[model samples]
Target: MIERRMNPHEGRSVINNGVKLRGSGFCIHMFYIRPVTYRGRIDKGQKIGEMLPMQRVYPGITSHVHVQNCNRFNVTRYL
Candidate 1:
């Protein structure tokens, strides 16, 4: 669904499930939704592009760190 900002200065945005997004302003967050199933265990999951946002105020340079680790289960047992 497309969402319009109340103030035009802020700019408008569009969001849809499992779809990429684009807009005029800086993208602080970008992600995707997907279903994960492992060993008959199923769950809804989100894939985030950026785990943290970094911006330089003086130079007006903005950037984001894209997370690459996709490991969901790392079990440890002690007996």
Candidate 2:
């Protein structure tokens, strides 16, 4: 899997529970989840689909993640 943050200066960490992506201004995070193939047999344990925004992923968590041009986020333990 490959995770790329548009802004590398942002602070991020991954705890036991989930991944943490943080940034002050506009931040773009890209996640790449790959399938494990063995002997021509592919294994995709979880359902893969379009990636949703943080708000959609964690409903009721934050009504608004960004305020104007300033954006701050630290999502923890959401795996």
Candidate 3:
């Protein structure tokens, strides 16, 4: 798949995520599930999905993640 990421600096880059999309230009991100909560507690996989944010949180810092999705999509991963 053709995916683009527009950084805060107004810079953009395209990448291939192995999805089948031809000539489709758009921005994208690869999201996944973790086994913990924002407060650093282990959470059950079955119940964690209900608490994750539906929107993308771009944490500029690499030390920790602080983004929260406002919607309850019950999604475990996204890209």
Candidate 4:
């Protein structure tokens, strides 16, 4: 499941989106992006969302997506 919401942690206008993968042992929250998938079973490599235009929001700032694990553990080992 994916839901769109404002995330003050990112910024006053930044969006904090959520993607819940049930039975997969983890969930992910995507910051600075807009969700394309609201609710459904998504496969690997499927398009779930797109990065927001941060350049317009924060001029001269780096444009990137912030992916965080809801489990509060480092996922670098899995990568």
- State which candidate has the highest lDDT: 4
lDDT of 1 at 62: 49
Clashing pairs in 1: none
Error of 2 at 9 (Å): 17
Which 10 successive residues of model 3 have the least lDDT summed?
Answer: 13-22
**Tens digits of lDDT, candidate 1, 1-79:** 1121111112222211122222354221222222121112212353322222233222454443231112322324411
lDDT of 4: 0.63
lDDT of 3 by residue, 1-79 (tens): 2222112122231111111111233222222323223222222343321222323344452323223232334446763
| Model 1: residues with Cα > 4 Å off, grouped in runs | 1-43, 46-51, 56-59, 69-79
Per-residue lDDT over 12-35 for candidate 4, one digit per residue giving the tens place of the 0 to 100 score: 555444354443556766666666
lDDT (C-alpha, whole model) for all candidates: 0.24, 0.28, 0.27, 0.63
Q: What's the ranking of the predictions by TM-score, best on top?
A: 4, 1, 3, 2
Greater TM-score among 1 and 2 belongs to 1
For model 1, what is the alpha-carbon lDDT of residue 75?
29
What range of 10 consecutive residues in model 4 has the weakest lDDT sum? 2-11
2 or 4, greater by lDDT: 4
